[model samples]
Target: MATHVLIIGGGIAGLNAAKSLGDAAGITVTIVDRQNHHLFQPLLYQVAMAGLSPADIAAPIRSILSGFSNIHVLQGEARSIKLDCACVEFDFGVLHYDYLVIACGATHSYFGHAEWEEFAPGLKTVAQATEIRRRVLAAFEQAERIEEPDEQKKYLTFVIVGGGPTGVELAGAIGEMSRYTLARDFRRINPRLTRVILVEAGPRILPMFSEEQAGRAARDLEKLGVQIWTSSIVTNVDANGVEMGDERIQTATALWAAGTEASEIGRSNGMPVDGRGRVIVEPDLSIADHSNVFVAGDQACFTHQTDRPLQGTAPVALQQGRFIGKTIVQELSGKPRTQFQFFDKGQMATIGRSRAIVEIGRFKFAGWFAWVTWLIVHIYYLTGFKNRFFVVLQWAWSYMTFRRGARLIVEKEWRMNQLESEEMLVDTTDDMPR
Candidate 1:
């Protein structure tokens, strides 16, 4: 009988593992995930900022793995793992496996304040991105209708908590949208007056990058009209606004790009996990005392030469995925399994259009050249050719016209409320600047 390998989570790690084991003798791979599609998470901020559609970054898992006859894709969430029986239980049924791979990713963490989630939604999934998009567009529309300046200011004020890559990117995008994209679209209020504040608890933004790079990024953000508030810790959040220290800033839209915790699977099934709920794996990426069970991706707490755990990046996940697959194949072929080694390629984050910072090994650079490099690297790694082509076209058009095509407010109730309000809706077609 062939060895039945069950891989949980269709993320980068899981997908890569399935592909690596394709057509291998005496082995069959089954990939199970909660979502039917594989999402390119690095570009999720663009979708939230109305720069790109969801379809441009997500591809169906079945379509991606259809060419491999040895692989089977299952659309289901794994509820629990029976270690003794070597089977995973889902809502529909259970499947036994000779070996199990868990690559479930992470989610937003509210830092012991779960109630704040409703007021400040984090960008993790497509639904969350669209919800944020709705809130942002709704706030602008409401601000246009309100005659009171104080009320309008509240609506125009946007707060993004956290100064990491996600927060910085979001603040920059909002600033650009207000200053450039929507500047000439409004008649009653100037969108250029919109205030975008990036609040960071740490002393500097982009702690992962060097102090020089972080300073440059901050300067670029300020140039784009984004306010930076470092060493500011958010104490409370509500429908009105966020409370930091002794000050309260009134705003209708508050976004959370703060810390993250591992998925529920990391903490369940008696798996050994760290403080952040990531599965603590052995040197070979296997669970302690359970050789047949393995963990990868953001959920795996891997410590190489550094004192801290590895950052939850796509490169780490991809390398670990390939390592785990190769290790399994070698062991099955009566060869010794090899220890996992991570090759540090580099890290890069885009501040806004035509601006970015990149660090590779001992070399670090910033500005337009880095931005071009960032664009090329991301486009090269994008999953599907169609997505890559559409993304490039959209980016080129937006760069030339300074307009975002995906700035569509999808929610119906919000639009209905704005239309029914007492304030007259200005004719957008006539008011738009030619």
Candidate 2:
């Protein structure tokens, strides 16, 4: 009988695992994910900023793995895992597996303040990105319609919480959009007067990068009209604005890019998980007392070297996925399994067009060269050829024209229904109380 290998989550890790184990003898791979498409998350900020469409960075999971006959892609969510029976329970049915790999990935963490999510949205999935785009574009539209200067200023103000890469990138994009993209478009309100504030609790933005790089990024952002506030924590967030310490800034739009917690699957199944809810796995990426079960990507707390855990990056997930696939093949072939060792291949973050920071080993640089490098690297990693081509072309056009191609404010019916529901609730409360 062939070995039934079940992989959960169709992110980078799961896709790479399935691809690595393609056409393997005596092995069949089954990959399951709630999302039907695989999203390239690194450039998700661009989508939210209207630089690229969701389709530009996403590809159907089935289409990507269709070449492999032994691999099957299932669009379903994994609800539970039965360790004794080695079966995964879903809404539809259960899937029995000889080996299992969990890489469900992470979501935005509001640091115990879930209510903030209503006001400050996070960029994670396509829906979230589109919603952010709508909110951002709508702010400008609202500003244009409002006759009062103070109200228009409030609508023009954009606050970004978290100062990490996502925060920095988003702030820069908004700055560019205000100063350049929407500058000439708006008549009543000058988009150039838009205030883009980036708030970071840490001493510096892009804490993952070196201090020098972070400083350079700050300077680059300032050139684009972005105000950076370091050592400032967002104490509260609401529909009106964000509060940091004793300071309160009134705004209509707020974007969150702070922290992330692991998927629910990592916390469940009796697996030992860390404080962040990432499954604590062995050196071989397998859960304790369950060698057949493995975890990878953001969901796994892998601390192979020293006490610090590995950062949940795409490269780490990709390498871990490949390692898991190879290890499974070796085990089936009666070969010894080896421990996973991560190779640090440096990091890069783009501040805006023609500006970025790159750090690799002892070498670090920031400028247009780094920005070009960032573009090349991201375009190269994109899934399909068409996606890569279109991204490059769109970026080139935007770079030359200072115009965003995907700036449509998409309004869903759910939001309209939600507003109506809120109004009804308010009316009922008013009739009952005062």
Candidate 3:
């Protein structure tokens, strides 16, 4: 009989891993996750800004893995693990495995200040994106109804706390959504009156990018009416607004894109983790002292020759996942195992319709050409062809007409237990702190 392999989490890492292993005849796979839908998280900001619907970027996990009869997708959460017995504990019961691959990915880190979540919600899932959309639209609605200048000021301002790619993308999208998309749509309020504030605790935005590229991105976003604050730390965040050092700004929406850490599967299973809560793994992407157990994607923190931990991005995660699958297959087939290597792909971000910055090897490009490249690259990375077509058409229309189509507010109602608080709807199934 083939060895039973159970994978946890249905993100890119887990899904790709299953695909790699499913092609081999000696593996029987079972995937367990809390949500049945698989979300393309890179474009979540587009959804929040009403550029794309939730269904456009999200798909049923079952549909993606339906081709493999040996693979099963379970829509539930894993509770715990019995390492000694090689079994996983879940809400549905227990699942035994010969080899376990944990690619549960990361969660937003509140920097030990969980209270800040009430004001500054992070965009990591479809639900969070939808909630942010509601809040953003609600701010405009509330502003339209109010006649007070002070109250209107509060409603028209937005603060984003972070300087990373997610922060930059969101800040730029929000600015466009307000100034261009909804400028002529509102009767009583001008969404163009919205002020976008981006605060970075670091010296510059996009520190990972080349200094010139980062500076160019900042300049483009500034031209779009986004206020950039560098070397500033947010001391507090509440429903009213965000407080940075001694300066306090009143705004209706504050977004958190500062930091993220690995899911608790590593720490809970007695694996080594770093200060940021990422699992420490070997060069081959296997957790220390446990060859049968592997970690990949945003969850694993393996250092390079320079001792720099790999960045948490889709490319890195997908490569690491495929490597793990190949290595496991080799071991199962009595073949040699090879060390994992990451191929460096260039990075790019779009500021607006015709403004972007891209870094590819020695060639760095900015402006309209790079913006077109950015759009193409994002569409290519999308999961399905249907999604690619939909996003492309949406972008084409937005670029030509200067209008966003998905601005309709959808307030979805659902029930939660008394013990469960609904603000952002925390997915604590994997919150096993070490």
lDDT of each: 0.91, 0.93, 0.86
State which candidate has the highest TM-score.
Answer: 2
Candidate 3 has its poorest 10 consecutive residues by lDDT at: 416-425
Cand. 1 Cα-lDDT: 0.91
Error at 216, model 1, angstroms: 0.3
lDDT at residue 378 of model 3 (Cα atoms): 81
> TM-score for every candidate vs. truth?
0.94, 0.95, 0.93
Give every collision pair in model 1.
none
Arrange candidates, best lDDT first: 2, 1, 3
Off by over 4 Å in 3: 412-434
Clashing pairs in 3: none
Judging by lDDT, tell me the better candidate of 1 and 3. 1
Cα lDDT tens digits for candidate 1, 109-192: 999999999999999898899889889988999998999999999999999999999999999999999999988888999999
**Candidate 1 displacement at residue 379 in angstroms:** 0.8
